[model samples]
Target: MKKILYLLLLVSIMTSCGEYNKILKSTDYEAKYEYAKNAFEKKKYTQAYTLLEELVTIFKGTDKAEESLYLLARSHYLNKDYETSGQYFTHYYTHYPKGQYTELARFYAGYGYYLNSPEAKLDQSGTYKAIDEMQRFLDYFPHSERAKEAQDVIFELQDKLVYKELLNSQLYYNLGNYMGNNYQSAVITAQNAIKEYPYSKYKEALSMIILKAKFQEASQSVYEKKADRFRDVIDEYYSFINDYPDGPNAKEAKDIFRVANKYVKE
Candidate 1:
């Protein structure tokens, strides 16, 4: 019985492959197009896009062109070939501005990149592209049903960028005064991150970094500059504590504040 089932399964697979090959080699465009649509519906994304890629060009200027292009893009997206999908999606909307699937094409174009966005530790070009594309979608379709989702994606990608900057700031802070005053660099990077993403979830963390970097910078300064630098640290501590009275880093912040105050006992 198991042998029979195995033979049956192998035969079914062979038949399916043979049918796909026949359709792929066929000269009839309509049959190929219909088969591609069916393949996509069945979630055979690679097969669907392989056929649709050809039909999109063949059907250009015809009624099938719009849908063929959109389907091709959608197939790539579902296949997780996001970079390729983004290109095809962009092409679809550009050529079919008023086409039936334009709205979806736009949304997927950006959302695909969002899915492709790398980790915060990696280069953020893809993340930036995702945010830019999502913003463009909002501008074009503010009332679109997908508008809320697009906006949310943009915010999420922006937060990723802020987090990347936070990592850089932390790196600088950890380096301390190695070779030069990386603590100041840390403070600057953290400050810029705060200014750019004031509402980020990382905002409190950034503020804490600023306060900590200022403390370190003051601690390492020459005796003549220590008093003035510590005063800056005290001011940063107040700003941090004011915004985040119960922030996660409050205890360490208090310790820094105490040390900073002791230094400036003028």
Candidate 2:
């Protein structure tokens, strides 16, 4: 019985392959379209993409154009060619506007970029593009079933951007007074990140970096500037403690504040 089943499966595979090869060489566009749809449904994305790639252009002014274009984008997406899929999806929505697949095209275009977003330490152009596309999806489809998911992706991408900035700020802080006043640059970077993403998960970390940077800056200042610089550290320490009394860096912040306080008068 198992042998019979195996034989049947072999025959089925051979027949399917034969039919696919015939379709691949056929000149009948309608036959290619139907086979492509079936191929896509069966998860044969490469075959579907090949057929749909040609049909999308061939059927440009025909009734099948919209579906062919959308299927082409979906085929690339399913094949994990997210960058190409994103471009095709963008093309579909721009040309169709009100086509049947516009909503999905917009959603996937952004989601494709989201899927393709690189590590935080890498270049973040893709992350930025993902956020922009997802925001546009939200603007156009506020009540979509995917709206909440899109918003979540946007927040996650924003977090990645914040993380990159945090790394840059830390790098600057670590370079304190080697050649230039990097502590000040660290403070600026952290402060700007805080202002730009007030609700980021990295907000506390950024604030802590600012406080640390200010403390380091004060500690390395000239004798004539020491008192005023220490005052700045004290103020920053207060701000940090007020926001996060029990934060991970609270103890470290307190240690800096203790040293900074000796320079300030009552």
Candidate 3:
């Protein structure tokens, strides 16, 4: 008897919930808009999204339509639905440029992409997109309060990009070392440092190390070799001196070249 009563009560509650859902779905714009606004104010983002989406569609040409659309985007953002939020924020910016929430929408659009960016070791599609949008914001609103914050975010993302590139170059250097063919490695490392960090105070020091490592590796092969192998070392020294004419390594490379040339040819 008690089990039968519980079953009946469960069915009745489910039917009531179904009827309430139908009523909510059939509500008019004024009803939906007020509900959405109240839900948003109370921080009920999921409920707000459902109501505002309905209100925006039903109130199409009215001023509230634009506000409803903007609120719908914000609701998704507050719910941490970043990709969906980004899409709706983009729509709001495009369709309602002069809307009251335009600047906030633009700010959040970039912020949403930034929040969605992957780890530094992963693909940086979101990072790059956020950078582009944030830069536009800074350019369009140089005096805005968010400009400095935008610039800071740009610098942080840029540093991640730089670190990733440096890691790749370092890998190449490591591969070159493992092959005991430091010549190519040294050249690649020096070129990478110049290309990626030309302003680095360490650039000259890095170039010097590449030259030294290449010369040392070749010369070690030079001294511990038979006649034919000795010739290869002498040729390398000649190449090094010709490539770096005025560096400290150039003078040493020249001296090694002359001695190798004389003995190897004899």
Candidate 4:
């Protein structure tokens, strides 16, 4: 009887062990999820992106779907696929607005756009978009822990845009007639640059461009028309003084204004 009982207990232990092994294999959801995580932990970003994407798709509608979506976005981000990562974050935010990870999604979406901003010499449309998105994040999540980081990014992007505008204006000025066939375009470009980037350090240079362009335009005018054109130069000089009362250019602008006013039309 003891032998019989011992045999039954051994069978029970063996059955339980087999069932547990089956549980390990059949519950592929966690295994797949872990596999992707392990790859990410090992810094295999590309592999992680692929595996996580697959895991999310297959596990759609499961309890872990939200987590899978978040992980998928992170995988793409870790792989430096900022455009794709941004898209996924946007998708996540739209689908799960109140999810636990919603704030993270918004932050990553804004950050992705920030990271994707083109070089300073290129068009700043993307940079402006980043700034707008980040500002929106701050406005919506004012009390969020990520608010300070978002503000910092917005400031940095704004600085980049200001710098870009200044460079463009200066380039137009340096290129002279080669940049545009007429002085009007150059003057207009410089003026617009100043208006667009009021905080830029290159305001003086922009003022100089406008002043020089107007002077040249006035000099090229014909007969009595020259006086009318010279008046435009004088007006611009005054405008410069009004905007910059104490800068290094202020005195220079005043001198130019004095000289330019003498040529004004009656």
Candidate 5:
């Protein structure tokens, strides 16, 4: 009985493949499209897109063009080809402003990139693209059902950029003044991140870095500049504490302030 069941299953697989091949060879584009749509419904993404690739162009200017293009993009998205998905989705909305799938395409075009956004230490071009796409989606569909989700994603991606800047700032601080004024670089980077993403969760981390960098820069300054630089450090500590009066880094910040205040006094 098991052997009989196995034979039936094998036959079913072969017959299915044979039918798909027959459809592939047929010139009946409508039949091919029907089969692709069915294939997609059955989760045969590769087979779905294999036919969709040609049909999208063939159906251009026809009633089916909008749907076929959108399906092609969605197929790529399900297959985890985010890069290709993003391109096709962009194309879909660009060509069909009021098309049935325009809103969905716009949403996924950016969301897919957000899903593929790289780590903070890596290149952030994709993250930037994701932010741009999500922003565009919000601008065009402010009242969409997906509007809240898109807005949240935009904030998350922005935070990723902030995290990247935080890492850069930390790197500069670590380098100290090896061959240049890296502490100053660290301060500049962190400050710019704060200015751009004032509401980011990393604002506290960035502020801490700025305060630390300022202290380091002042502590290492030449004798004549020490008094003036420490005064600057005192100013930064006050600013950091004012913003994060009870933040996690408060203890360290106050320690720095004590040293800075005492130095300026002497």
Candidate 6:
């Protein structure tokens, strides 16, 4: 019985494939549209995308245009072709501002970028684009059911930007006074990151970097600049502790402060 069932399933699949191929070659737009919908429903996104791609322009300005365009975007999204999906979604919203799928198009256009955002080590243009899209979604649909999710994604993307800056700052710190004053560069980078992402989870780490960078900068300065630079390090250490009394780097910060205090007179 199982063998017979399997044979029947194989025959059904072959017949379905044959019919789909026939439909693909036909000029019958209505038939193609119906088949595309069915293919999408069956999760055959590649087939659906192929069929919809042909019909979207044909159905333009027709009653089927809105749904056809939206389906084209969704098919790409379902296929995990997020970049392509984002483009289609943007097209849909731009053309059909008040269409039935406008909300979804706006949300997914940005959400697709978020889904495709690369790691912190990689270029983060996609992450920034995602944040822009999601922020626009919030501005347009503040009460949308997906608003909170969009907001959360924005926060996550911002964190990624902060982390990238953190890595840059650390690199500068590691370079130290290799050829020039890299510690100054590290302090500037960390301070900018702290200002840009005041609520970032990396806030403490950035502050710590600033303090350490200042100490190193002072330590390596010429005798004429050492006392004033060390005093700057002491001020940075106090500000770091004020913000995070029990911070993970408290011990290190305090030790640096103790050393810096020895250089600057009361």
Q: Which has the greatest lDDT?
A: 5
Go through the candidates in order and give each one's C-alpha lDDT. 0.92, 0.94, 0.72, 0.77, 0.95, 0.94
User: How do the predictions measure up, each by TM-score?
Assistant: 0.98, 0.94, 0.64, 0.76, 0.97, 0.96
Off by over 4 Å in 4: 1-27, 175-181, 194-204, 251-255
For candidate 6, the per-residue lDDT at 11 reads 100
* Candidate topping TM-score: 1
Candidate 2 on 107-153: residue-level lDDT in tens? 99999999999999999999999999999999999999999999999
What are the per-residue Cα lDDT tens digits for candidate 4 across 96-161?
A: 888878889889888989999998999888898788778878877999988988988987887787
Give per-residue lDDT, candidate 6, residue 39: 97
lDDT of model 4, residue 17: 56
Cα RMSD for candidates in order: 0.9, 1.9, 8.9, 10.7, 1.1, 1.4
Question: With candidate 5 superimposed using the best TM-score fit, by how many Å does residue 28's alpha carbon deviate from the native?
Answer: 0.9
Please report the TM-score between candidate 2 and the true structure.
0.94
* Tens-digit lDDT string for candidate 1 (1-266): 99999999999999999999999999999999999999999999999999998998999899899999999999999999999999999998998888898889889999999999999999999999999889988888999989988988998999999999999999999998789989889989999998988899999998998888888778888899999999988888888889989877999999999988998996
lDDT of 1: 0.92
Error of 2 at 80 (Å): 1.2
Off by over 4 Å in 1: none
List model 5 lDDT by residue over 170-243, tens digit each: 99999999999999999999999999999999999999999999999988889899999999989888888999
- Over all chains combined, what TM-score does candidate 4 have? 0.76
lDDT of 3 at 213: 49
lDDT score of residue 152 within candidate 2 = 94
Per-residue error (Å), model 6, residue 243 = 0.1
lDDT of 4 at 137: 81
Q: In model 1, state the lDDT of residue 190.
A: 90
